[model samples]
Target: MQHYTVIKDHISSYPDPIILRKEQEVLYGKEDTQFPNWIFCTSMATQKEGWVPKQILTTPNKQGIAMATKDYSAHELTANQGDLLLGLEHLNDWTYCKTENDEYGWIPTFCLSASN
Candidate 1:
């Protein structure tokens, strides 16, 4: 008779959720008072959270901004310096983007946010 071994796995190692530290104080949503120390993924990354100021740069296109990723080149979109990327909608798909100049289009997700 042979004994069998089982391996259990869990998502504990998932990268700790990140929160945008604003003005040296962590901004919490109206409902986050309970988990004061925890970074809620929902509120941290969502449209309802409003636009968080981030330092982003231009992509290889040399035309727009770079939404960068950990691997490869960042997704490129049309955004110039000092441009205010408005609303949480702007954070959505890399494709079909509209900048402050009203230039609508697409880009890559790898295009890095300069703040990140």
Candidate 2:
């Protein structure tokens, strides 16, 4: 199994969100017919110390990718360790975040470390 990481430290808001897509072809000879498998996601939520993660919207809406509704688009999704995050805006130290904004497209280079 492949290991993943959820950039929990970069979160900057609440109600995080993620999407999943099924694989059509087997990359390493793995046989599985699960449609809409796990892909990637983005949300916002302040951690224990006001750490917020940035929400990520898809670039071109991959296969089986479900788009969030306007009502629930602002909601934050839950993320745990090994969730696999790219990066967004900087908060301070050991923390960064991103989000799916109407104006700004996909920002995958924002990051903030934790303040020790």
Candidate 3:
């Protein structure tokens, strides 16, 4: 899978839209995106999956970035500026990513800077 970095803060995991709909059909016999313009993706590190806005995901022009836009606390990590991250997938403005510490979560797209 491709890699990315955490650019924004307060990124969290929701249900994968595709899987959510599939589960909805299985559990309640229905399928839905839950919200308009939402999409789905799976995490790379912990394999956590979730749904996000369609506008969050974007095609990266470079490898990744080296800093985080805000302080993030997850997976036993406190991600601050200069933390290395790998982009696993994109969902709208959110990017499913894994940190150098192997922590996984979603981050905003604008916070990343493609590695040179």
Each model's lDDT: 0.28, 0.26, 0.42
Where model 1 places Cα greater than 4 Å from the true spot, the runs are 1-76, 86-93, 112-116
lDDT of 1 by residue, 9-115 (tens): 11112232232332222233222343232222222232222222222211223432223222111223444434434222333323223455664333322332422
Candidates in order, TM-scores: namely 0.21, 0.21, 0.42
lDDT of 2 by residue, 1-116 (tens): 11124434333343332222232111111112331222233222211111112222222234423332322222233344444433433222222233222221121122222222
- 1-116 in candidate 3: lDDT tens per residue? 55544344443343332222211211111112444454334433334444433333342224421121222222222355556677766555545677876767656656665553
Superior candidate under lDDT, 1 versus 2: 1
Candidate 2 lDDT score at position 18: 27
Which candidate has the top score in lDDT?
A: 3
Angstrom error of the Cα, residue 102, model 2: value is: 13
Clash count per candidate: 17, 39, 13
Output the lDDT of residue 20, model 1. 32
